[model samples]
Target: MIHPVAVIGAGPFGLSTAAHLRARGIPVRVFGEPMVSWRDHMPEGMLLKSTPAASSIDAPQRGHNLVDYCDAAGIPRLVTDEDIIPVETFIGYGEWFQQKLVPELERVRVVSVDRKSGPGGQGGRSGGGFEIKLDSGELFTARAVVVATGLSGLAHLPVELRGAAADGPTPTGPVSHSSQHHDLSRFAGKELVVVGAGQSALETAALAAEAGAQVRVVSRGRGRVAFGAPPWEQPKLRPESPFGRAWSLWALSYYPQPYRHLPAEARHYLVRRVLGPLGAWWLRDRFEGKVGVREVARIVRAEAQDAHPVLTVQTLGGRTEELSADHVIAATGYRVGIAAMDFLGHELRTQLAVSRGTPKLGAGYRSSVPGLYFTGLPAAASYGPVMRFVCGTEFASPRLAKHLAAAHG
Candidate 1:
């Protein structure tokens, strides 16, 4: 069967896009397990930095907001817990929303997407759509494709470390990115080294410490930056208050129109400022003295020492030291470049085009390549930094749905 819209990834963005399309009476086929990456990768006892009201998946009119779900489930709406949306709870909410809203979703992996051509190199009609090949060897065609694959595909490790891993496994024992370190039980009582100073790094350090490993955090800087500090605490120029704030909180709280209206430069600036920095205040108290912190140091080289791994690190002051640990965890971050999406394949990736380091997305989130669109984090550079959060769907879904309706009609 030929579907009008095929959404890749069943995470928040994919589910949101699918639900919106279905609501508009557009036939939508969604692939990927609902909250698969979030469910599998995130650690237990972890909490989201976003508020419940701001982290919802469905539209406000639909009444499936996270607040409603928490209330029904008897989860307390405490201020202390406000910043602590459990990963499981969020995943459960996504799954619940998917089941209740977009039930036609298929749990499958999209291997590649290619444009279909017609007579005279017409390359299919405007609404002629394209074909999607699944890893299972199943083929399906759709008029449009929305990539909601989320952040799983884009991991950002240090350049030197990435290069070292490229040649083969690190000579100094096992070196892996934090995103790949899913199980901690195996490292129990082993010395573990974690790099980066962001929330992920801090959390991984805490987890490693809890696992009875000698955990040490190596970073280019030190000190804990709190997450979600009171708006008044920000610099006056970028204060949280409306009169002095660079942008209105109300405008950033939702998605779509507000983001669409933001200037490309402003959106780019926001992404660079927000996503690049590290803040670990939420877990600071729990981690102080418990997880060793090495600051102003860089991993110059990593090679195995006997069976254990040894890292030659250089500090900013030119002081060099060799540290040995059983394993190295780089909680660096994610790489947002479109090249990271392997499923897009070579031909489509070349045709999609990029702007300001992000995919050049149209108003409907469609790429230059017809029928293929991008949403979520990859679209943040165009849509605004809020696209990285769940709240983005509020605007993204409706806007994309309108485009789908227009194209399908």
Candidate 2:
């Protein structure tokens, strides 16, 4: 008898892991809407930050790449790092990958995950495996659990903007996170303020202005917004990494397993800073002349005045001023916190050894809690920044699947 493994997400990592596991003849049940984040959470006009080659979802079988999807779907294939892939195209590719590779994926949400107990159970550890509860109230057991949900519940709103309102930032409220908006066009003919200098903030500001909204983009730090050089201008001497063309990035991209051997502080610093907050080379034209930018500025105070949000900003030269908008979008980016994974039972959360709110992963990306694993952003702290991108699936999925097959076989 074989007990299936439970994959909790249907994104690139989840789909790829399930595909690899199935190839190894492992029983698997995957849950969550296919590419739901890309389809519903991201704004309509947004483009992928990753290049064409970097955006393809990994599969055990050959010919299931984005180029293959394009060939099958009759769309033009983006063949190089210079070619920009649209978010819609990427989302479609992921869904197509799901259709081809993980047809057994369940669309229900997993409400809770806990250790299976009773006969031969040691402490809260499951003797027969783990129990999974779905949103539909169905319960089942799996030999192991792999968490690959990318960026869910990890949106970070700066404390300065968060303390402004009584109810705090909400999707419908005066203040909202960039991840909360699916369409910035709803703010058309309205005053919009975007906080942070990252790709999200710049793109949101540009898109809002394009939709005819009065837009003001604020850089959260004391520095101006930045962009990568055009593809042609980039030097070709350095080896290529999934994120960019550099030695550090190349190591991170291809040699992620060794990242765990580095010092804890060094690992943490690299994860936060590498591939940090900059727009793609292609977004320059759409952003530069179209949106107003406030550089080297900080939002010192925030308050919801009546129904409108007002910000007290301090600029580089110590100048202070008030700025108000119909809505404030915080593009502060995401921080991985394992505690935010509320669907995981309290006991599992407690038993799992963690560092800085993330699972302390060993070889095969296994957490201290046996049979439980984490991937994607949650694995970045242990594996390095490469895990934050779609291309990391090439390394993470097959490796974990082989580890599981050997462990259980």
Candidate 3:
């Protein structure tokens, strides 16, 4: 039986993978709301840390990039490497790319994916395909599945501020991650404490302040909040890329596959540090004096006191202080792990090898479970840090599609 390949997401990795599979004449089905995470999770007025050239979703064919979309949409096309990409524009471009290349995307939720029992109910452990159930009550059987559910179940919230709430514990709780808020206007007239010094944390603090919220950033790390240096100051020898201007960035960008050969400790280290905490260069001016930042401070204890969060913090000079806020936002970023994918069956997830909670992906991004693959951030462990960004799709989409096609054929 010739079964269609399943792409379990509609983000950059999912759409690009489906497009490549279709281009190669492999039957494919893609599920999920296109750019839903970006559209609903990020705050308004946030900008991408990636430059225009590296922000395009990879498509197998020509004329399907961010620049192409800008040209067709008549927006001022970003030409240089210095242009800051707005998140809204990027979301629009993603929708455009989805329409142009993978219009058949099913904008529905995939409720569950389990290994199907075939013949005498003994095939799941052998070579039986997968049973995919959709929220709309539709079901599908696919010979192969690409689990590219990007950052869906991976938002990391620190434990201390987990229960604080400006209103109360609702759908998202009192203290929530930065990914939970799309509109910062709701934060207006509220006191918000944004934790972390990363781009998301810094930008969210800036957005919250601009939206009329009294905001302060609580960074526990010793490193000061940094912005990418001016383009003119950058050396021509290394050049610039979205991941930053460094030899390691070049190595990771051009040699992701070989990166897997390095010691697991090294690969993991690079993944955590390569594109480490820093705000976008343009956001620096707005954040410096306008937003209050607490550097060299750590939250030693936290508690909720009457619809607010009270944080006990230790400053650089061995000083303890208390800061209260109506709401606390954890900008701690995402932590990718196969176990977080609740839709994936427990048996299937357990059968796959794991590294740092992420599925240990093989060549072409396949998992230990045959015919099951993972890409994007989940692939970062085995492939390198590049897989964590949208630019990695240029390498992953075609390679994964080719492997799946060959295996199917």
Candidate 4:
């Protein structure tokens, strides 16, 4: 009956929550390779859209921020808000945070998490805790489970391109999502079509061109792709949000707790639109002309021909255009569908109430199930859009840890 709190992920939310729980003298077990998603999925040489100050994992105690890690490790410090963070440095910083705080993080994969059957019956929620099984064949029970798995099972590829994209054992094919690539150099001397207007799609196109690929960005928007306003033009009246500055950004970033009080429709709308789509200001120099942008374009059909993709797109003014590329990269961002998380048993998934395919979280970030909780991107519907960024750990970690400590004590 010695059940510890289980944290399923070692990213910003999981690492920070476990640190706070340990600081409160609570027994906890954290799993997943530290920052595995950020390390493995993001393309090399890419820069973070978030500034240095906002790109930190929260710790209940000080001395664990990005600045402290940079200073301690003798890495060049990011001294100003204007400084853009590199992906590699952030990954290293996350490892440093994990080592210094939640060093007990297990690198093994979690196969499944199921609700243990109680004396009442299998569907009953009382008495028995969670039964967690790992890939290594080890099984453990937890008094409470915190799921902070970031966006592991949520890469979104558009249905239009799925026919040409093979997401199987060998993902090498005519189409793929941006998340699957770590090096853009693989596309060198080849025609590449990148979809979407967001940072991921735009940046990938830029990197592909820089790597000597014939790159073009195809955006579905009727308007030209946008870049963030220059620093001086960013108004001071609106404080910075995770994505950028706006009055609504100020409200959501400062008031995640109150976000639940707002109507579900309003919360969902803000999450979808606030951080809509824009390339970072620094990236425009490389992206503007080096990468061809087919704005006001939509893919009408995608098919495989000669081991490559041939796309027929509907352009603005009711014209049709056919383009060929060695591969199509869908940089469409993640969709938070709890059912997509196959690690959760069917019974557990069915038992939890849902909002727009995401788990409905209640007090202390707990899901509809009493002892199960969720955080990070999946909590955006219940918390706010801030949950999608590393900075959200500041609000989520301490709050969730304190609740778990008191509930289980």
What's the TM-score of each model vs. the native? 0.86, 0.96, 0.94, 0.95
Candidate 3, residues 100-141, lDDT tens digits: the string is: 889899988888888887765432234668999999999888
Give the Cα error of residue 43 in candidate 2, in Å. 0.5
> What TM-score would you give candidate 4 relative to the actual structure?
0.95
lDDT of 4: 0.85
> CA lDDT of each candidate?
0.71, 0.86, 0.83, 0.85
Candidate 1 stretches with Cα past 4 Å from truth are 77-83, 119-127, 163-173, 221-269
Candidate 1 local lDDT, 1-409, one digit each (tens)? 4456788889999888888887777777888999987887766666675655557885525667776677766876523322567788898788888888888888778888877664543232443467789988998777778888888768776665653365443324367776665566667788888877777888878877877778988876442333444433555665232111445554454434556556777777777565444543466666887888887556787665555567788877889888777888877777688777877768777876786557978778877776677888888877766787787787787887787677555
User: Where does candidate 1 have its weakest 10-residue lDDT segment?
Assistant: 239-248
Q: Candidate 2 lDDT, tens digit per residue, 22-132? A: 998888999999999889889998888888778888899899998999999999988887888889999999999999989988999999999877467632234667889
**Which parts of model 4 are misplaced by more than 4 Å?**
119-126, 166-171, 222-224, 240-243
- The candidate maximizing lDDT is 2
Arrange candidates, best lDDT first: 2, 4, 3, 1
TM-score between candidate 3 and the true structure: 0.94
- Give per-candidate clash totals: 6, 0, 3, 0
Error of 2 at 388 (Å): 0.9
CA lDDT, candidate 2, residue 233: 76
Instruction: At residue 62, give the lDDT of candidate 3.
Output: 94
Which candidate leads the pack in TM-score?
Answer: 2
> Lowest summed lDDT over 10 consecutive residues: which window, candidate 3?
165-174
